[model samples]
Target: MSREIVLGVDGGTTAVKAVAFDLAGEIITSHHESVPVQYGRHGEAEQDMNLIWEAVADCIREVADALEPDDTVVSIGLTGQGDGAWLIDEDGEPVRPAATWLDGRAGQRVNRWMRDGRAERVLEVTGTTVFGGLFPVLMEELLEADHERASRATTQFNCKDWIRFKLTGERLTDYTEASRSYLDVRDVSGFSTELAAELGQTDLIGLLPQVRAADAPGGVLSSGAAERVGLPAGTPVGMGMIDVAVTGMGLGTVDDGQGWLILGTTGFVGTLLPEVSRRRSQNSMVLATGRGRQVLEFMAPMTGTPNLDWIRNTLGLAEVPWSEIEQRARASRPGANGVVYLPYASPGGERAPFIDTAASASWMGMSLTTTPEDVLRSVYEGVAFSLADCVRTLDMAGDLVVSGGGFRSDLVCEILADVTGQTVVRQDAPEAGARGAAVLALVSARRFPDLEAASQALACPVERFEPDADRGLIYRATKAVYLQAREAIRPVWPVMRGLRYQDSAGDQS
Candidate 1:
């Protein structure tokens, strides 16, 4: 018998990563390529559909070729960054550039929704407050901004859905992707007409894609898809979940009350639940993962490791590697010696654990004695603190499966464990999303009955971190001060924004 593998494609915001995994969740081989996005105007982020396809196809073909001569790719699965608005004609051609989840042009609509209580109502239905980066609002924003392009569009797809359509000729999505902002997921099967009408964008009702679970068969990889991606025709494909959803499962985050955290370009802290949460927070996203379980996602749009990269560049420490930075941070003690940093410096502001569009980064208690290393260490603590706040809000006092680049740092893992007062677990697989996607495909292909069995059989944590009581006590006090600092700085954020806004107006005038 030939070795069998599944092709798991992670079509992410900045790049496409195609990984080959066996039923055991081992990474056989992988290929990756970055897909660029264009920022045309304020809040406008677009990617060429052709460019995305090229990157994904190239990665798939390359990874498949890397397999052993006798090996066969039995299935294909996909996952991508969530909430990008991808529009295409009936023929699967792009009507316009695909707007990414990071695009913020719909701020005007987001503001209106927040002001008029539409967002809170959205929280009641989908378990997530509507925002500019979501698909539904982007649909309306697209139509109002570019009627010509919007009129030509025949349907809408999220980033993963678009990639899956290109792979299997099926225009569909899964609950993990669609539940965030598009469809009503109360039943966890199809679109919610009631929620659509509530949003006043029922016109988009027809544009929504049919959603299925990750284990459901959407379609087979067609001959055309095979040729384009250098794979065998008729390869069975599964409707993959959102990146976070699949990543969570791959990390073995299935037990009730187990929280999963992803700290990539953004911060996501979520826990698996037995049922959907009726009382949702203004900043939490309740996701039905199509597995009869609900996940409460309290994501922070601006708190991430990117701030560290930016700081490294700003401080002219480009030559300093992350390993060295980690060493320096460890040499210092917890709390960074009276200096505190808030990791919300992004121009777009923050989105979760409380939606504050005017929020930005703040550095308080910095003295002349503060060194570059001190600031760097403080930044590490700052990002952890931000995620700590989210974990607190989610009330996740159980085990946490952690993933992302920041996980490479033992210090970060320790800090997170300490701050959250929970054990932090890390698996051997770095590509959690790809592992989940592969397992999901295996289930669809009947290699595994469901995600739980797959996770239990193939996944195991390599390292575990427990909170230090001494450090936890320190963080308890420090977190209170940090919370106070965040509140105190809120009023200052809009004032800072007004200066720039008034300057821009004056310039135009």
Candidate 2:
């Protein structure tokens, strides 16, 4: 008999990646296709649904082409960037460009909901706060603008769910993705209409599909989808999940108390919990796991990798190796000579410990002695500090497992360890999101009884970066300064936001 294969699709911010894996979770082939992000004035970020779907099809075909003719593909799983709203008509055609998770057009609505105590009810149901980038608020804004269009809408799906629907012809979303959509996480079925009514839209609840995890069987691939992607018809398709949760699974951090930090285009700090931890409230979201366990996800939505690219591109320093920058950063003393930076580059403003939509990046305490290296080091440190804030808010004091492209740089791991004062373990796998989706496919196929067992079988080991006690102490002190600066700057943020809003309104008028 030929070896059974599974295909995992990870639709990310920058690209769509497809990985083919054997029954043992070993990767067979991988492919990626870049997708363009559309940015507009007033922090609006969007993506063309048609283009994204084309990229997905291209990636899947590329991966499938690499597979041996005799190898039988058992199932397909999907995981992608979370929270963005993709509106579709009754025929499942996208009505508009998707409001990417990076977009913050719903900030005003989110703020109003939060202030009106709707956020509390949302939290109680969805296990997440009302954030501007989430699908619920975005959907609400879309509905208010055109009630007739919303009334005709059959479903509102996340990126992954939308793609899966294209393949399987099923309208469904996983628990992890649904958790971020202001749906009831406690309700195993789907969104709670009662909670939806409290947020001023009773009908919106009906737009969501049934909730399942990446490990659940979504449906078989339709003949049309199979022919388009060069896959066998009736191939099993597994339910999809949010990218971060699947990344955790891909890292094999399925055990209770095991934590993973993903520093990709965005950063997320997540850990598996036996049950929900209701103690630490702010900055954390509770999501269901692939293996039926609950996870506490603490996200520091904005980190400076994008900023690093911006600085490099704008300053014509793109050719400078990041290694050289790291070496220079190490030569400098801790704290970047009192220079601090705030990395709030996302349009949805900021989430986590502080839900400040008006927050913008800034450099403080720079002097004549400041070098480009100092600024670069501060950017690295600033991103680390944000991650530390999420850790503190969740009280997640455990072995910190790090994954994502950022971990490829040793400097990032060292800086993260020093900042958090915790040992950072780098996982062996780089494409955790794709791997996680494959793991879910395996589970749905009953290759393993659950995610935990699959994790033990598939997880690979890497070096651990332990925190330097002396450096850790220095970071502890600097963290105090960071906190103070954050508080001091809070008052000015609202005024900045008001001005920006006025300017945007004027431009529209």
Candidate 3:
């Protein structure tokens, strides 16, 4: 007799991953295909929509090929990176390349909205702060800059929704992705037309896809998709939440007051709430958790492990192993010998804890005496400090659940715990987003009664990093200096941006 397995597909910014898991949530097989991101000189990050779908199909085919002979795939669930504009025409063809969440071309519009109180009107209705990469902002930009292309788009899909549409012919979105844009966190009506009108994006109201509950039944696999992926036709699919919300579910953070963090390409710190809270950071949002009325408040820093990637390559350590890097970081003290590094290395600038499109990374207090080890350690500590900032802004307390590729280092987890002054519970699931999708698929398949029961059955913790009191005290003082230094550099960001623009223009000339 063949055992049943659930397949989960996560289409991320950089890759599309397909993972299969048994009923108990243990991984059975997995495959991933990398999707390229095109970065423009004007702070634009995009991906070819069709190429992304192709990657998804390829990944699924690989996973199916690796499946055991006795293992029969039962259900499919989909999740992906949230935000940005993934638009398609009536024929389901990409009207243009996807403008991802990292795109900052609409920075001027976001700034103007912030200054004119239009952003406030949006926050009042949506419970989300206006940012450059948000759908409405991007749509406004695209409509003004390329009216022809923009007019061709008939429906706006999120990353996963686009993939789901291609697989099951469902042109729908879930509540979680909807909350990132115009959805009122306080209401279940989905899109807020009034909010769209406030932003002068009323034309986009008709382009919005029908919103569905996260655990609801997504359409089944089509014959064409089934043949391409080597899966049986009519395999059930679940409407999965956005990547962040689904990842929280995968971490077993289903109850109110539960918190989680992801230190991946970006750093995210989130706390679940029983109700929508009015008070939130400009960089934080009150997002729907996809469970009825439950919400998540989170701050996402633009860059996370990329700081390490930057320093490693810049310092001629690209070939060096991460174990050596951790060793060097450990050689330095908790405070990194007074050097404070800001982890905003993204070209599009920082978003969470504060929205600054001109923000850039800096190493304050560096001296001739500063050792390489100190610099490396400060980079790690800087990212941790950023996470701590979000935790404090959200007023989150208690033990913090941490995951992602960055937390693989014991030293990173220890630093996070000490800097945040909280116990950091490290969960070792590498494919957390996919696992969460699989959990939702199980519920959609009626194999589980509810999300909580399904998640609890798969909850696994391999290690815990308790905060050191002495180190915590040291980081507290250092964090004060970090904040002071960040504020001091605020005025310099615009000046820096201007200089870069002039330099680029000169190069072009």
Candidate 4:
């Protein structure tokens, strides 16, 4: 018996997962470990870089330990949270706690660029609009706050690439991760020095790592990493793609026009396009795909499950179990009893359909008749509607692959199906990112010729939520109300910001 298995490790926002799979993408076993994230002054989100590595090592070890006598782990692949600057020195050691993608310390820099038309100029070359907490502006923050530490930095990589560096002892990143940063997304190649110049950070161009293609060798696992993960030292590791990019692939949504939504720490809505359409917008990223004829157009709103998590923790709903919370949502009518929630509570604001950094979440048409359940249910609908808005922008037309924590709730899936008026396919694999990483590892191991074949053979969906015609009609009206409210609140956002600022100053006095 050929005990050949490929392993994939995913470093997520709040947890790290390692999942093992056979050649046809069937799950053999999986292990998970929770990790810590620290938030400090000025919207800062940081995590200990070493803890992530240890988590990956621990999870990998757990999975490796479960292997039968003949079981042999062939190749390993990695995926992680996108964005947030992870800095390391020439020696490949972290200089400080890695800045997470959620960190907003660089909002001011983004605002400055947006105002001076510098953002527009850079977008011309990169074909990407600026987002708050992105790497280019975040790099400026590191250099400005502490030049000494910044000077020692020789290379910068995304969260996933940092882990790959430890495993393979070679620093490199794939195009998917590169496109998330300051790289030239138009051609899907290397860094755009011109974009760096517009941001007034020319030096950052050199710190970029060499670009590596997917399924290509990302150096062999070293003795140190092998010892920690209980794997052979010479095992090949492939340069993995972004978590969002792999989620669709893991679901086997490879055919042209196939699309999916990932409701993780963030809400990502994407579709596979037939051509490389380089339409530039703050809400979308145009990416070149492995198949020369296809491209990926995606938009990720900064708020997703995190927004809902806030409602539970901040609104005293934590005492009630989430299962009960789901029941409340399910009890609520389609319109949440006429109460509506805008999920733009994120400081980064809304980035889909339109880019509004100052956008604020609001409850429109709430009344004393509204119950806590109504408010909570509206939040679920609010997030789904936001993602639906983005999907409309991409024009994704097909059965939707919905994967993430939010989708675990049957109510959430029902609402997505109704709101989008499409069948929502939910897979049994909870760790879509890790499973996708396994798909990459299998490709690197030559288990199947390439990704498409591996995906078709291995990817499977266990549940399907088809749209209810009656409910779809109801949600069509519900979505209209949501959009109208969104427009109505635009002018009020500036006033809201001013009042909040004034309230802060008054409290200080």
Candidate 5:
């Protein structure tokens, strides 16, 4: 008797990972292929679509090879990073390099809309604020800046949608991805054509793909893809949601009031709710959970482990191990000796909890006696403080189910639990996005009745971190200072932006 396995593919900004899991959700085998992003001088981030597809193919082939002779891959689920514009022509070829979610070429456009009240109008209709890298905002910029690329584009697919098209030859997107900017937050599956017209993007209506639920019946594997991936032709393909939604599912956060956090390339934290609430602040995204009409009030603040990465690299500690860095960081007492770091290091600047493209990282209260360890530990605390801000904005009150590469350190996990005042639950596993996609595949294959059932059956065991009373009190006081420092530094962000570009202009001239 052959063992039944499901395959989950997560096309992330850093890599394309293919993970195989049994019916119980235990990982059987997995493979990853790194994908590179091309970063531009003016907040432009892109990737070659064909290269990403090739990486996905390589990962799938490697995972297929790892399967035992008696093991059979019954279904495949797909998920990836959401937002930005991946333009494709009628023949399903890339019109240009994909504009990724990290791209901020449209920052000025977003700022224009915000100043003219168009940004708030977007919030009113879509239940979310506009960011530079959002699909619609990018589309508006592309149309005005690059006529050739805009005119050639017939469809706009997110990262996973592009991969799905290559696998099944299907052009479709799920509600999770669509809800980023297009679908009405009140109506998960409905398109807002009026909002499209208001943005002067009515042309986008024709470019949008057919929206479906994450577990809905998607296309089968095509013979060409089967040959390339070494999978059986006609294998079931599950229409999986975005990495955010699927990661929540993989963590078994299906019930209302469940909160989850991802501390990867960016910091993401959200609370699951039964339905959309207009009363909530519009700063965060209101997304379809891809499990019935459930909603996820989500925020992706531009802060994460990258703060640590930046400091480590800048201070010539790249060769040192992360564990050693953590040890040194721990030597510094709580509050990093009065140093508070802001973790907005991304060139695209900060979004979520607030939108500010000119935002940059800073370390305040640094004295002559401050040590490098203080700087390092303060970076971790900055990220924790940012996540706490998002949690407060969304009213996410309970245990936070946490995942992502950043949580590997005990110090970060403990700090996050104390700072947020929530018990942090972690499953020490990578490829959670892929695991979530596998859960969706199980439901799509009809082996499970619904998302909730599939998720419960395949859930991973967790390790919990309880908040320390003393540390929580200290964090509470520090967080107030953190918020105050953030606001105080806001007035200088634009001046910093001008100084940076001035240096660039001097070099160019």
Candidate 6:
């Protein structure tokens, strides 16, 4: 019998990863390549589209080289970070630097749109609120600043779609990714004309490619792309969605009431819903799951890992292994000696609980006695508290499965369990996004009869970390202090906003 394989590509914010999966949905080999992100002085974060494509090409070739030439790669699936805007010319070459989701330049425009009562219409159409760094807001900003660039643009694509077009010579997007745009997501496919018109770009609807889902085969690889990636010409590629949605599918958390928390560069809390719940209006997004289901995503944009990176860099703690830091953090009592940190290093403000662009990260209640370990532990505790706040707001609290780079630390897992007062299930596979993309590819290729089956085949066993009864009590008590600190800081936000405005005005003058 001939061996059958599938390829999954995940174009992430920091890196592009590719994995080759066997018929049973087991990852045979994986390759990764990091892409550079350019950050400007004015809270601007961007990436070179051409660099992203080069990383993608490198990742694909690496994965293909690891596999046997005769091992038939039946299909390829593409998934990526959502909401970054990529403007391309008629020839599909990017016309501008891709604005990353971390960019906050559009906060003012998004706020104005919200104040004008346009947000409700946007929510009704796109199933998401006006958020900074989203494609529409970024595009609107570009159009306002340089009409020439906006007018000359032929199409607006996300990072993954750009790579897909480069490989297949076909322009298309998946419903899961499309839902993040200001376009309407209520439909299974295509943009919402009503929503597009309200955003002042009815003709912009013509610029978008048709939207599909993971189950649909998007297009075949062109001969040129095939030669570059070491794949057979005409290999089918499945329509892919956002990384978190695919992560949910990869973990087998696709049923209603089942949820997963991904702690990557950003943290996302998501649940798969059987139907689009109107209750999502309160504090969630109802997006397509790319498998004919709806996914409710309650995202918390900042996680603690980045803060740890900051500590390591700023404090010159690179000599110490992260495990040693975790060990020291474990020694500190809950509440980090009454200190707390807000991890908003990316400057796009925050997305969940409150959309405060003026919000900046701080370590409240620090004193002369505060040690580096205390501050570090406080950062971890504070991030867990924010994540807990998001999960608590959900109408239902289900079993929480945790994935991503942060979950590798047992100390962080214990802290999460203690703070959330719930069991934190750790996935067996660390690369949930890539595995999810492969699972989708398998389903699209009919290797699995259904998504659930594909999940069962691909889903790895997880280790559950339950909260300690005694430690849980301490964490609960400390959580009160954390919440109180957060509340106290909320009122001072306006003052901080005033200071920021004055700074901006001075700069302009």
- Name model 5 segments beyond 4 Å from true: 290-292, 503-509
What lDDT, from 0 to 1, does candidate 4 have? 0.79
- TM-score of every prediction relative to native: 0.94, 0.93, 0.97, 0.93, 0.97, 0.94
Model 1 C-alpha lDDT per residue in residues 291-348, reported as the tens digit of each score: 6756545565554877777778877888988898788777767888777888886555
Clashes of each: 1, 0, 0, 1, 0, 0
lDDT by residue (50-122, candidate 5, tens digit) is: 9999999999999999999899888999999888899999999999899899988888888999999878877
Model 4 backbone overlap count: 1
Residue 293 lDDT in candidate 3: 76
How many clashing pairs in candidate 6? 0
Cα lDDT tens digits for candidate 4, 16-114: 999888766778888999999887545577889989999989999999998886887888988899888788998889888888877766666777888
Could you tell me which residue pairs clash in candidate 2? Answer: none
Tens-place lDDT per residue, model 6, 1-509, is 56788888999988898988786767789999988788765567899999999899999999898887678999898888878678888988887888888887777787888789776677777677667787777788878766787777888788788888988988898877778764445544556776777778787767677777667777899999999998989898887778878887778877777888888778887766666653443546667665554655566564346777787677677888988888878777777887878776666777776676656777888999998888888878777777777777664464689898877888778877886778899997668887788778777777888878988887777899988888777777777787777667876764765565455546744
Candidates 1 and 3 compared: the better one by TM-score is 3
RMSD values, in order shown: 2.3, 2.6, 1.7, 2.4, 1.6, 2.4
Regarding TM-score, does 3 or 4 come out ahead? 3
Which residue pairs overlap in candidate 1's backbone?
Answer: 43-105
